[model samples]
Target: MELKKNPKANVGRNSSLYFAVGLNVMLLLTYLGLEHKTYETETVKADILMMTEQLEEDIPITTINIPPPPPPPKQLVTEVITVVEDVEEVEETFVESSEVGQDDIIEERVVSVEEVEVVEVEEDVEVPFAVIERVPQFPGCKGNNAELKACFQEKMQEHLQKHFRYPPTAAELDIQGKVFVFFLIDKYGKVAKIQTRGPNELLETEAERIISLLPKMEPGKQRNKPVGVPYSIPINFKLQEQ
Candidate 1:
């Protein structure tokens, strides 16, 4: 015995359609809610002021006293011109042509070497210390080229140590740096043309002074001839830590 149910009474048959309809209605409601706008009424404040009568007062007119325009700048004769006769006559100078014409006589004479004055100009030649064949010999320094160079340096150091005096102001102000002293040992073995560069002028001056105290030495030679030798040394101005 099988029993048959009515197809129109099935509940789950329209469930999908009902869900789609409900979802569409929820989306429409959400859109409407989001798009809803409310307007608020604001009360305006009014201030009323009463009119008052204004009184008019007359302002006094004041006159400014100005000095009558400086008496027009007085007119006066500043200069007077007078004609004077010429007293002294100026001699007229005649310019002669320097170009030689065919009529001008030219004297020809033979020149002899003995009659010609030969001026021997001593050339001032400079050679660097490192490349010079013979380095400048310090006082009491005698040796070959290399030994002389070493001795010269040793003597220079001794001279600097003997005369090294720090400027009191520089030491007090705490100025310390290395000063490069460049000096030329002239062909006559005299230290000359001393130049210095340093962080401060005081240090440079002191370095210059120390180099100036060096004794006259034998000039450096290049190719068996004395030449001015340029030497550079650095003097360090350092203060001892307390």
Candidate 2:
């Protein structure tokens, strides 16, 4: 029973106070140990005011005499012109009023009609190859539907094969590309408006030249009327490895 002494006394009551004191001390130490930011003091240097001597300007009062403006020029007087009537007197003939018989009455002078030239305007209508009633014919394409189309294609291929000249620069540089050419056959059976698209400019130029050299063919007809035909074809420019 003697070993258990002060059992009813509170031991943990002062521990909180000690912890608070320790925490405050640690905070104070931390605050002291941290690098403090220094602010530079604003230096207000008093500048001595130098009195500058002011130059006195003597103002001279001068009176200027302005001449009066000249009077305006007198206007020209116009003479009154008297208008004299130059009427030629026609002799008065008294004719008694009588019945206007067709044979006795004088006929009024008739005005002749003036002739004018009539101008005619012609516009070429464009039609596609697939939809036109009568397809365009090449030089030697004289046949019906399927045969005509086949003959046209055959003639076109033959023409290409004959006129297809590879550009010297393209062959020299080994440049190869496919050029798409779009040409129009006018109503007069003349090839016009040739355009080309390709990877190379030289290739495009060559294709356009070949297309432009195409001979005049019979203009395509739609509903038995001649029309312009828009045809597009692709030509390949390939360099052979020799």
Candidate 3:
């Protein structure tokens, strides 16, 4: 068959013909690429499903149960005891004789008796006297009660001159105080149980020493009998002003 072409239509158709042909070729290539991608995806999915089914059939599952350990054995304990015996003392018995007389038939009676006595022994203790004659007296003390207090004060002054050593801090700081000491005038009139009532430990110690060195005096008299008496003394400590 012979195709007839118009001159005007051919002139207009030639310019767009090349562009239309290029567009159709691009569309056809895109459709073919999409179909190839779809086919590859479906093939991969089928292979994954088959692998999953084979693995599920090959793997096996198991369940196990374990029991706990047994308890330990019990131990027994034993204790032993010992006993001792005691001995008792025996007592002695005495025999008695009886005599009978004629006429009235008088009988002499004999009596048996046990006697026990206790004896206590006391040891005599001789106490040594203090060496009062050796002690140096204060200038005004004449060994009287009033003089004794002055003698103690003088002894304390002597002690401070010889042995009144104090700590460096206390000495440098000029620490000074008064201590009240209470003591007993014993039956022999010697100082005993001297104790301090205030601070100043060094002063208290020196005061106690002075009191201990005091000589025996006539004991305090109450109703004309020697009786214990309480005595209080104040020891004053002061720093010499330079």
Candidate 4:
């Protein structure tokens, strides 16, 4: 069996067109709705400026009477006379010429030995340890120049070891460094001009204290003459590991 329908009666044939038309209309409506904008309007009022005519009052010019300035005062002229007193006369002293003439007689005066003063000046000479003819002798140290030098070093080390004491403050702060001490042995075999350079004042003070305890020794000699000796030594301050 075959079913026949009229050409105008076909609903599916116009359904696609109707759907496209409806879709297009819906899209247009959506676009218009999305594109629509509303702006708020505020009313402004304008005012007109009116120029009003003003009346000007006439001001009268008043005259003021002022008296002229008083006349200048008159000055009187007076004469002055001065008198000077007489000054006393002074005598001029004559100076003799320092040049001596061959014909001039010179008096002979005897100068006694006791009448003339003799001044003796002692010179301060400093000699280096290496170049000194005789180095300062430490107590209980005796030898030749080379041997004396070695003995002195050994004795110095012994002395340092005997008196080495770390500063309590420096140790607490963990301060460690090498202190360079420069001291001068005077001609009288006494230590002087002791200076120290270290990382901290405590270390320097300790080093100075140790150096100050050094026993008096024989003064250094240069050319068989006693002289001040300048010596430098280094003291190491180190912390032992636990």
Candidate 5:
């Protein structure tokens, strides 16, 4: 038998076909891998961007402003007022004597004598006569009235001499003033409820001291019995050269 050429064998005999098939498979695998890697990278980048934006939004910033403060109040002042009473002295009058003549002759003679002045001598020294009226005593106390008046005058004089002496500064400045003090003599003749009515501190202090040192007065009597009485004492301060 003679060898004959097979057409089918001839048909499958192209090297280029096999090469094309292998190249197509390799290209498809490479395209799929590349697409997968691109998607993963894009997702990672988007996540990172979102986290950065959120961090920026969560932080906060602030600003502040402050102002200043205000001042104080004032004080009040008061003035002092003093009241003084005037003392008047009484004048004495003398009467002349008339001489009587014989009744039948009906002649009358008037005799005039020179006025004689009686001078007051104190501590062996002569002083001008000054008449001081006796202070009338409270009613119903009888002889005790005279005694109480004398005692009160003496005590007042002594108290003035002792406690009313002012400081040299006060005297030099001529600080002459008066103060009115109010006090109550109890049933037992004790000085109580003493109060001063003026604004001068020094005057008030002196008045208080003098009033405190006063001896217990025999209580003012009503029908010969002890009774409480309220008294107001006016204290006068004057400066004289020593």
Candidate 6:
């Protein structure tokens, strides 16, 4: 009546059921532990965020005072002047007497107003342009009247071409025009009285900058006397198509 199979053979059949139950129990415990830890971490994060949001509630609002800007200064206004033509010329003569007499009383004579220097306000004075007698010599220009004048013109043109620059703003806006600049070569051959007329102020500014870079040169002369020579040249600002 006892079992015919070995006892260990039946024991192996129950071993599989025991292993499956233990593995399922272990997995369930690991899942529960991970869920507990995740809940604790979320609780801590929520508390930190809530504390940050409530922190501003306990603080008081503040106001600051700002100063106002200063007032603008007043501008001076000049009076307009009217010009008049000269119609009369008076001559003044200064005569000294050499005869001295003790009985003679020297009477004072009214002096003529012609000897006095009268200054008139002028808007613009036309400076002379030097010609054959003597002409303005640009730096590095040498030779006779014809040679010097030709060299000067060549150098000036070269200078303008070398320093030609197109304003970035003007280029971006696609505006191109010719600028005419008038500058004076004074008695000392120094550039002065620079004036520019152009379609745009930016173009004029560049033209003036090119002329201002001129080196000190031999002054222009008229009848062997140093004089101011007004010179004018045109500069073209053009942008090429891409």
Using TM-score, give the best candidate's number.
1
Task: For candidate 1, write residues 1-242 as lDDT tens digits.
Answer: 99899988899998999999999999999999999999998999999986697788999999999878666777887897999999989999999999999999999989998998988998999999999999998888887999999999898899889999999999999999999999999999999999999999999999999999888988999999999999999999999998
Relative to the true structure, candidate 2 reaches a TM of 0.51
lDDT of 2 by residue, 1-242 (tens): 56665856978879999999999999998998785677899999999988798789999999999999999999999999999997988899999878777679697976655555567887868988888888788998887856777888899999999999999998998899899999898888888999899999999999988888889888888888999989999999998777
The true-versus-predicted C-alpha distance at residue 204 of model 1, in Å, is 0.7
List where candidate 4 sits over 4 angstroms from the true fold.
Answer: 1-115
Root-mean-square deviation per candidate:
7.6, 10.8, 23.9, 12.9, 36.6, 26.3
Q: Flag the better candidate by TM-score, 2 or 6.
A: 2
- lDDT against the true structure, per candidate, is 0.94, 0.88, 0.60, 0.93, 0.63, 0.82
- Angstrom error at residue 201, model 4: 0.4
lDDT score at residue 83, model 4, on the 0-100 scale: 81
At residue 228, what lDDT does model 6 achieve?
A: 76
- Model 5, 1-242: lDDT tens digits are 99999887786678789889999999999999788743334444444444545444556666666655544556667787887666877789888657665664664877556565668763311111111122223332335445656656566666667776564565666666788888776656677889986546776777788888766655665545455566677888777667
Cα misplacement distance, residue 83 of candidate 6 (Å): 70
What's the distance in Å from true for residue 188, model 1? Answer: 0.4
Q: List candidate 3 stretches off by more than 4 Å.
A: 1-169
**Candidate 5 TM-score over all chains jointly:** 0.36
Note the residue pairs that clash in candidate 6: none
Kindly report which residue stretches of model 2 are placed more than 4 angstroms away from their true locations once superposed: 1-121
Which residue pairs overlap in candidate 2's backbone?
none
Better of 2 and 5 by lDDT: 2
In terms of lDDT, which candidate is strongest? Answer: 1
TM-score of each predicted structure versus truth? 0.56, 0.51, 0.34, 0.54, 0.36, 0.48
For model 2, how big is the CA root-mean-square deviation? 10.8
